[model samples]
Target: MDFSGKKVLITGASRGIGKATAMAFAEKGAQVGLNYRNNIDEAKRTLKEMPGKGHQLFQKDIGKTENCKELIQEFIETYGRLDILVNNAGIFQHHKIDEIDFEEWTQTWETTFRTNLYAAAHLSYWASQKMMKSGGGRIVNVSSRGAFRGEPNAPAYGASKAALNAMSQSLAKKLAPHNIFVGVVAPGFTETEMGANALTPEERERLLAETSFKRMAKPEEVAHAILFLASEGAEYCSGAIIDVNGASYLRS
Candidate 1:
């Protein structure tokens, strides 16, 4: 129930679920390391609101492969260790197949995959190395329910998330020997900027109507799930995909 003295890193921590997760960890006594891109002011503002020690910001875009390593490096340099890594940096673009340009499509794929998966992959590798040095650690990859339900026009985004599901499982097996746990949180429609702006009122209504709760979930709800998975309470959880969708994506 406590994360006292734990060093944790949260990517895309400048806003949304990432920011919420950071606060959750900080309040629980974990030292939070935040990663942001081109939003120094907001990142700092958010950091000021967090509740614990070691709250620092590392400006790195996961869209660029190299930044992933740099983020881990800066985290270690700042905190001397990494106890948990939350892969939350990702993007989504809506482009139908016929409307998708060759260049734009490539960029979309790279943007979504590199930031969503590869960055996580590199950081997982880097984090695992650090974890091994300290006996073990925890990794939580932020995925989406769209990975299972499919995005209307964000195919690359869906693929990237689905890939994280597989990747986390693989890494869990690899890192289990070292006591490091790897898992994913596949959130359904949540009240993040992307979620709120992704559809019009009518569209959002339809989306909400599909859920048992008939409303979008708060980011803190999903953050709570992430916190639990990283908790000592969830010590045996590895390669688990915890869904926080309010029954929107339940299998028939």
Candidate 2:
């Protein structure tokens, strides 16, 4: 869809899926807000590679609660509107239940939940207010399949995503009255920086075997799905979880 003049605020957009999503939106003629924490250089690199125009950055540690409101306000002030909010910024780690530390556990919980879930919630609330004043809008929460099936070692991360999925559903229900559509893109393992660094050869092969495609997803593949959900064309797709998993978990 042609998204000229549409504004999207994407979190963790310096690399991987977020970067790909931002570029895709830009190429489609949307103004993008590229959010990053510590990698301004990398974010700028991604921006330089983008095909379109009118993208800006707002760097803040979103894991901190205070930065959330600040970033959202900055987004509104910069773009003059918030048509789409992609809650894509997050951190991932593995843990064994017995070896998990209090700081580790709390950081995992706070960071993942705050960045993955709370960011969308705060932005959606404010963005929806803007969209309501102007007519309507969309929200695409970058969730994970881990949310639905859950994870063994990384319980906190899994639970946080699950909470985000639930929040999308609840917000969709509540926001539909004002024409705000909230949906989720729950992807399986993909060939992102985290996936490459975390997965061993044997583990990658094993994970690939889970998919009918026998491979990991490309960043653009998931971005295309997010674009669809975020479009005015998908106005009726509220409260839906679109699993872009290459048939990894297709039901019989």
Candidate 3:
């Protein structure tokens, strides 16, 4: 899909799937705004690696509600218009019920939900408003297979993504009449820094074995799904959730 003249904003673009998605959009001739909380170095590297120009970077902690609004505003100020918004920023933490104290448990849940769900919700709210006036736009949320298969060790992460999926569908219906589309891309374990850091060698091997491909997903594979959902002629798939797990998990 040629995104020439389109403007796209992607969160968590410093690395992994976010970085891949940002580069993909840029390569397709879209002006990209790369957002990252920390790791300015990596973010700069990603911006430099993009094939096209007009790719900018915004460093904001989206875990906060206000930051989400500010991020979208800053992006619009820089790019003039937002054609797509990819809510790819998320946090995954293990807070087992039996293993953590009440205070810690609550904190973990708050952080995870704020970063994973609330940020996306707030960003979408503002982005949709802009899209409404600009004629139309697309929003693609990066979810996880754990939302379906479960994350026993990271229940909050799993719960947050499930909520994200629900919220995306809800917005899909609400925004469709305005010509704005919302879709979701749920990927299994991907070969990213965060994914690798979350697993032990043994656990990694076991998880890979579960997939039909016997390997973890590459960040670009998930990016491809995100782009497809955001591409032209994909408005019909607004509320759909495309799985990129290589058959690791399935649900009817």
Candidate 4:
């Protein structure tokens, strides 16, 4: 879809799926605001890689409530208005039940939940308000197949995404009358930097076997799906979770 004149904002956009998604929107003529936490070098590279002009970068940590509020305000001030908000920033740390101590467990849960769920929720709250005034917009949340399939090693991550899906559905129903559409993309085993670093050769084979394609999804593959969900024709798909997991996990 042609996103000419549209403004987009993406979090954790220095690399992987977030980077891919930002580039896709840029290619389609949308001005993108790329947000990153600490990777200034990578974030600059991503901004340079985008095809279009007016693409700016915001280096802010979304885990804090105040940062989330300021981020939306800054993007609006820079771009005038927002058309899409992709909540792609997240953290995935393993907290094994049998090995971690109580303190470690609590830390993992707090960090994961804050970065993965609360940040998205806070951004959505402020972004939706701006979108309402602009007449209409789209919010696409990047979720995970682990939400339904189970993340045995990362229970907090799984739970956070499940909550994200629920929140997306809730907002979808709440925002429809106001012309704002909310949708979700739940991808499995994407070939992102985090995914690559998490798997060994043996683990990779096991993961491949779980899907019919015998391979993991590329970042762009998932990005394309996100773009589709953000399109005007997809307004009816609000609350729908489109799977990009190569049939690795199925939900009825």
Clashing pairs in 4: none
lDDT of 4 by residue, 157-243 (tens): 999999999999999999999999999999998999999887779989999999989989999999999999999798899999999
Could you tell me the lDDT of residue 55 within candidate 2? 90
TM-score of each: 0.96, 0.94, 0.99, 0.98
Tell me the tens digit of each residue's lDDT in model 2 across 1-252.
888999999998999899999999999999999999988899889888887778998898887777877887898898887888888887677866789878877777777677767776776776777888877788899889888777787787788889888989999999899888999999888779977886779978888999878889999999999999998778788998989888887533
Structure candidate 3, residue pairs in collision: none
Residue 11's lDDT within candidate 3 is: 94
lDDT of each: 0.89, 0.85, 0.94, 0.95
lDDT of 1: 0.89
Q: Is candidate 1 or candidate 4 better by TM-score?
A: 4
| Rank ordering of all candidates by lDDT, starting from the highest | 4, 3, 1, 2
**How many clashes in each structure?**
0, 0, 0, 0
Better of 2 and 4 by lDDT: 4
Local accuracy of candidate 3 as per-residue lDDT tens digits, 71-141: 98999999899999999999888888998899999999999999999999999999998999999999999
Q: Judging by TM-score, tell me the better candidate of 1 and 3.
A: 3
Question: What's the TM for model 1?
Answer: 0.96
lDDT of 1 by residue, 1-252 (tens): 699999999999989999999999999999999999888998999999998666888988777878878888889999999999999888877767888679988878877787888888998988898899999999999999988999878898899999999999999898989999988999987899877777779878888889879888899999999998898968678989999999888854
Q: Write the number of the candidate with greater lDDT, choosing between 1 and 4.
A: 4
* Least accurate 10 contiguous residues by lDDT in model 4: 194-203
Off by over 4 Å in 3: none
